[model samples]
Target: MKWRTLENTAKIFPATSGKKDERVFRFACVLKEGIRAELLQEALNKTLEEFPMFLCVLRKGLFWNYLEESKLRPIVREEYRTPCSAIYVRDQKNLLFEVTYYKTRINFETYHALTDGTGALNFLKMLVYQYLMLAYPEYVKGPVSKLGITSSTEEDMVEDGFSKYYGSGEIKEEIPRFKSYQFPYHRREHGRMKLIEGLVSSEKLLQKAREHNTTVTVLLTSVYLCAIAKDMSIRQKKKPVSLMIPVNLRNIFPSDSMRNFFGWIDIGYDFATRSNELEDVIAYTSDFFKRELTLKRIGARMDNLIQFEKNPLIRIVPLELKYIFMQLGAKFISVGENTAVFSNIGKINLPDDCESYLDYFEFYTTTPTMELCMCTFQEHMTLSFTSAFVTNRVEENFFSILKELNLDVRMIVSGDSRAGQEHFPDLSKETATHDFWYRLFTFSCLAVMVISNILNYLLIPEMFWSRYVMGGMASAWIITSVGYRKRRNLLKNAVWQLVLIGIGLYLWDYATGFYGWSLNIGLPCLILSCLAAITAIIIFFRLNSADYMIYMMITCLAGFLPLILNIAGIVQFKALAVICAGISFLTLAALCLFQWPAVKNELIKKFHV
Candidate 1:
């Protein structure tokens, strides 16, 4: 398989993304009519031809992660799961982007490692254009012909713009080290997000920006900072309300690459030292944008970023260790300094011919804190805020500021775009039922334990059998917990159960008496049974060798422990131990002979450091 290196900016995503922040973004184009799934698939097929780089999958290397060409293809489906849900599995070969539709909206969601918002918007535009042409050929012959739209060459689409524009210069990057204030509100359930999309008139927002003598981004960022300040206490106000604004590098560096070609600047306003007036905030934001958004400053930042990636010692570090350091950098350094993210995807322009067929464009990204994404189409600008917090106090305060300015702000709640309902599934009913049953079962368990202790005190008065019952319940809880946590990977769950059950059985034997039965008979039997069961599972499921080899090796190593114990004179019985040892040795030797390459690679990845 052919592979390519990831850009410097793209390397951090895999390490930092989790259930809370998926590092995924969505671009949706709502048309006047409902979306036809078949026609949308056809359009996606045509669009993928022009953007082949998006077809690759992220892979692990010795020292870094890379993208490898994948044979898997994307298919358009009706939107079922939440938007911006995880698309990249660590070792799975799946597409980095997905096209899903709901009602009249055509949603294009992409993993940040594949492309940034600007690059994804280009792909969505092409897809919408193609779908329109296929759906209405007559309109294409009329209005579409008047506009000129052509696909860029594939070579340009896959170009690494960072490498192309990186200059050999001394880096003098300075980042403020002060900690920013984070929202104290509790987060929603995992994989659940609250989206507050404010649709307003572009003309009115522009006029307001003009009155402030600032650009729309600076003005809106000012409003966002002020909104966050509304909920801050006097003590919290000491920290600055900082916003990380992403800038399109293609505009300044001149590249047609669809890969990640963007940079960000941090702008903040300290309410403690400066005036809290809106005008003051706008002026501060505008001044910071001017100073930090220049070509020289951005290039220096980019050079600094690239220099770290190019370091000899850093390059030699294993990918697994790199993930730890990068994850720490993202948590303490990247996330610690920013209060929120405000990404301006800027204005989205479609052909005038097809503009009437579209309602507007919407953009939003998953974030660990609050993020305000702005996109304009025709006369409408969609300001989308996706937050991890359960409360929308900051988002509500944001629109309240806009409403105070006399700007028309309407909530986009039509069709499936309603907050908490559009992206997340309605699980309240099911959750209620599950919670009721759980509570009932827990109460029953407590009642049973109390009854057993009372009966033991009345009848036996000295046996204390209830203690063994408590031990049994504890063992069952541990086993069930492992099963629930590792449900996604049955092989891993089986391995855990095998190890945990062995320990539990030995402890039970020790409590009964210091007998050698657990070591000589019970443990050997459990290991033998686990080996047989896992082998049958692999055959039945046709699992990949890479997925099960490590677990199998672990079980085989455990199988030898029984014979070792017998040889140490700890086991009175020896027949079962000898059988387990012989089978384990054969199993291990067969794995080395048949699946040597996978075993070798797995070992290297685990112990590379």
Candidate 2:
């Protein structure tokens, strides 16, 4: 069967609103040390020159999308910068060797759009081991047979031993169930990770989970649940905190993409609210979530989404106006939505070759952006733990949980990533470009936003109640004020903005269908409006040094903003659903460009006078 291009209007709702689709994420881990950065850089230069495949990203309808920026491959880095470095940045690493370092820490980052937590973990373990030999002089190094790399050291390691999972497998087609709707794409607030990267086997972790009378995910989830509860209790004395564990629909569906093939299903009970017995909490959560993970439920969810997207129209209201209502509903009600997500990618496999030389993997879960994500992966038997948290308190709780489990963390290490650690360093010392032309470009962006908002306010009617209008206005307002001092209260205001947009989108759908308006017009606007809104917030936060709190507020805002887009009249344009997600991604990319004022200012400085 030919892989079809995702429709401009994707079949969202059931399959994960394309907003959370598998195709959009990517994960990469760096390994190597002792060698000068230049050596690794040279190796990367050779590798890319040798094999184009060394740098690629996944493409729509295609399994792999390599880096379009080939000369300098854009690597998705997951940098661990805490316990010393706290900033995490994602970018392209020109060379594979730069990722591995015996002198410094290794770096790893994942693209949620590419693969789920599990899939990325497999890749990370292998990537790390490959780096180990190349960096340590004792591990293994020969002519880089894989992608292309030449190292000075030589060690015996089987490349096949590194990877533990399959690229291709029996695919079963099953549908997943979840409340579906349409909204803009968003980037969550992501924080630093206190990572514990080790070597543990899947078999051991599963056995442990079973021994604890829990599923692997449940057992891992228990760690997070316990950690979060502890974090909350230690902090502001909040009640039981809720957690969301992303259940891959593909796991139950059989026929799902290995990439972006999952949905975040809630999986936490208030730790403080949990039963006195850990068994009760574990059993209840395991059982409850276990049922939610079935193919039947997934199918029903997808089926309902299909129906919702395909239903008949209500030809009474205008398209734009209808969306306003749905957007409103989403904002007022949904966006401040689910509390937090705690996901687990069960024991993962490194490629067979690197297995013997490798350790386990680590990953983090973020929604919009999470308060903290307590994730663990078992390689052989030792459970490697990681806690992605914005603050020390949240991290401490995660560590405390391991102690409670009677598993003492054996070691702690830190890494230096120009991307993550040097995130927003002082601008005065940096030197980039400060061209007059670039200065003009900066002004041009703000100018364009100003003009766009002005045009929107002028062209859009005041009386019309559509989510697009609300979202656009709100988004515009955010961007306009983005360069100013931060506004914490705006978090709630932003929440309301998304809420209104959700309501407006829902209502506007009815108006468009009832009035016999073209869905093409209604949907593109609706979906793209979500695109814009999510983008605006992401940009706002990204410019502010990747602030986790703001990201949390905005992602939560975007997550539930689309429920009503399919209400009555709107047709589910899955292709457009994908479009919304893609555009939102673009928005995020744009924001990432401006992540650091010094870097941005450098460019302007160079191009300016």
Candidate 3:
């Protein structure tokens, strides 16, 4: 039940998260056989015991949101959702990580709030090791001991390394900041992040880098910059195509914490300022790496970050307000300050026994514009390019550079193959036909309403005729609501629509007559029906119940309105009101009883009173 404030660097993730940028990272382990659900779940349970930090849920504190150990358990399932989808702590309060298997691949996705790639990789390693031991006991060696799981103590695993190293007030020197060149933002089609992976021989790539007198990361950064430069307009050519390189701090600061302990260095090449030669880009990147990768520079930057967090004014602000400022800060820091991120986890070295059971390791980071993650296993090195932009010109140019280097590259694209196609087949005819029917139906509804209203006004002047018009309008609304196409969460959207219609119907009935039916039956029935339907969907679909708790709570609150109306003598039906109140109270009480610890923890974190 212990709670810990988020690490200094980890605070930005929740603030910056949005529909397109989820702030989640994916680390997939391709196993030799299909993942056994039972074994994986068991393995995750066992792994959680050792790395308890990863089992925590995020909660809001007065000044900042913190992580607290969750009472719920992590479950394993088949992979169904898209990779790197948003992991809302409110929804999945138990764990900040997800484990799913697709065929032979075990996908381990972690929210950046909980841990960074290094921490997640350690957790995944242990999970896979345990799974292998359970599934193929004959092939696996010793019990998790030989898996190279970090021997860091639980205290160390949860340690705020940034604060540990830089919290002291002694380092007061102000570090100068510079504005880097920005890449022009392109709107991604449908806001779907696309991943394109290229597998090349590790030896060939290393040899090519050595010939240029640079390391793999520097060489790859150079090539990536070259690719970006190709698409730069004459106006943009003056700006530096900066690449943000994430450096793992564990190597420098010597902390065993699995929490976020990383720093980034911006490396750039200005085509308009200097030669766009590959060698020049490499040398420039190498020089920057040599200077910025040093502990002195990184430590100074960490100190500067800590100073901002330690500001007295910042410390007193409420969490909600802090979230707004942090979001604006994250956005301001990102826009025009850098081009893209290049995170290289380097070659993954597994124990000899476990190596044969694994195929390859893949890493993906959610990016605002574009991100490239590099990892190598055995002879093949894979460079994964995840972009928010639809076009793959940068990726194409990157691989084309490798092809020129005489390296045999194999490309694999996730999602649609027509993503980067120049000539998209015309769908106007199909869309026109669909729109035509929709417009026709809409026009028909409007015409009926107008004509019926006119005829009723003209012929039935003595009679109340607006009811017919109201009926027509209701019919039109119902048709429109039902006919609308929802691409995602269709059932949830439909349920909401039904609830809205139910409310409208009750209001209309109340306006027509204080018929005891709407209040006596309709309102209570709608409340109970929505509750029942949503509960059934959650249970049947095996969705996370925490995700729908807010909706259920709102329904319960709405249920009370009927009882208040009854007390006010607006609705004379006492029986229905009592029934509605009973149901709402009982449901809410049940939630509190079952999830008291989580609820209490959430309140403590959110209100901090």
Candidate 4:
């Protein structure tokens, strides 16, 4: 089958997919009756024929990962896992999406690299519409006039709206960049993302937005910023609380592309500069919407992106190199800006007959921090929050504002046995156990530093910093133990711990005066120790040697740094560098000789050379 490169916006997703952010989203439809596996499978098979773009697998190309049509069909089974799990393209060769049913819910989980929420929702609506039609032919006997249920030509469904809108002669103006504030929260836990959803009265929310003279998106953004401001520490109040709002371009641009076609706008408020009142936030967000969310501004942003992509030098770079740079760019963009993301898919309108069988729809997107996905069906508008943090203070504050506005809200926890409608609980008291442990560990580290410093002052007057260095080493051990206990991934946890220890030891050695020990002995020893540990892990565990190829390459790469420093005359340590280099080269040679085929295949897959 012919292959197609990912959309311009879709290119970053594959590189950004990780445990913290899987770059996946879920659009689930709740049916009034129980789901039938056979009917769902049949419906999926039929739907793929109409939406052939979704029937493809991700494949590595020289310059990028492309999609090729797959011969294998998707299986419709019971939903046994959490929502929005990682979908490794290389492992699941046939499909980029999964169709699973749990009781009355039919979930369509898709990787964001393949399609956006708009595309995924369209496909899901068709799948469910087809299933309902097949199960009860009498119900959908009339004309099939629904947007997604009706057939669409391949040309229209697979059109690249970005290319269509790209203009060569467009003036490239520098748009103002905003450095938004980030929340002062701990790093994400080592497992799946947490999901919390609430169903509210759509009419009430709309009325409230109308009263404030703003749209739903602006109102929600304002409320979210207010929530963050309420939960922020006094020191954090000095910065702006920003929210990233994704805007679908299909509405503005003329295109029938079901693929990714969207842009994002950052709306923020600096509590230090502006008042923390709700009215001020809403007014500020409304003004931003008026200025930045216009066609001219958005079109200019799109043109600049397209122009950069069309650059001659960037276009010729190999895919492997591009992937590395893209990963770094993605991380920079995510962490450098925005506190949270609020994606409003707007109200979903279904046919009168199909509406009766469907209960409500919930949407969620994976995020490194907190994300809110909003959609409305009938009278219910659902806001789903997917977060990495265990604290729910922001969520509590958000809903509390709505309650004060006299909007009736219903809460639903994903894994909670109390599935039905219930009042919103006090999330302040609902803390995860990990939160407690993290606080305790942080406090203990502080205590250790203080006591050690006092002891060093009394006993070792000349080396006052010695005890603090020891305390730092003790803290590294504690952090590594906690990480290992939570993730159970020995290789990842151990490598990070080793990195921390190396950094601490080097700093201590430097503090005692310019000593060659850190570079000549300490550094080489750390590199050699890593090599030994990784080798033992592969052999004793009887694991696929190919799986550790990247790790092995990284160790060899680190070993080369010392040699480079010595060559530059910065480090006068020839013997240590020579020893480390010899060991690294020998390990690489052994792997190449014994596992040549595996190493070759892995390199080809990763580098796409």
Candidates' RMSD to native: 5.2, 17.4, 7.6, 9.6
Error of 4 at 375 (Å): 0.5
lDDT of 4 by residue, 101-175 (tens): 877889999988788888898888888888888888888643445654445578887888888887622346556
lDDT of 4 at 136: 81
lDDT by candidate, in order shown: 0.82, 0.40, 0.76, 0.77
lDDT of 4 at 401: 93
The weakest ten consecutive residues by lDDT in model 3 span 422-431
User: In lDDT terms, how accurate is model 4?
Assistant: 0.77
In lDDT terms, which candidate is top?
Answer: 1
lDDT of 4 at 86: 75
lDDT of 3 at 584: 88
Off by over 4 Å in 4: 148-151, 168-171, 174-176, 414-609
The TM-score leader among the candidates is: 1
Which pairs clash (backbone N, Cα, C closer than 3 Å) in model 3?
60-605
* Residue-level lDDT tens digits of model 1 in 1-609: 445678879989999888888899999999999899999999999877767778888866678777767667899998866678888876556789999998889999999999988789988998999899988888754333232333457777778888888873337767444478878898876557677787999999999999988989888999999999999999999898888888899878877888899988777788989988999999888888888877888888788888788888998998889999998888767666888889999988877778889999989988888899999999999999998887878988999999999998888742222235543445344332534654565566667778888999999987999988778877876787677666666777788888999999999999999676778789999999999988988999887775578789989999999889988899868899999989999999999999898888766544432
Worst lDDT run of 10 residues, candidate 2, spans: 155-164
Instruction: Record all residue pairs in model 1 with backbone atoms less than 3 Å apart, i.e. clashing.
Output: none
CA lDDT for candidate 1: 0.82
Task: Give the candidates in order of TM-score, highest first.
Answer: 1, 3, 4, 2
Q: lDDT at 134 for candidate 1?
A: 89
In order of appearance, the predictions have TM-scores of: 0.77, 0.45, 0.71, 0.69
Which ranking of candidates, highest lDDT first?
1, 4, 3, 2
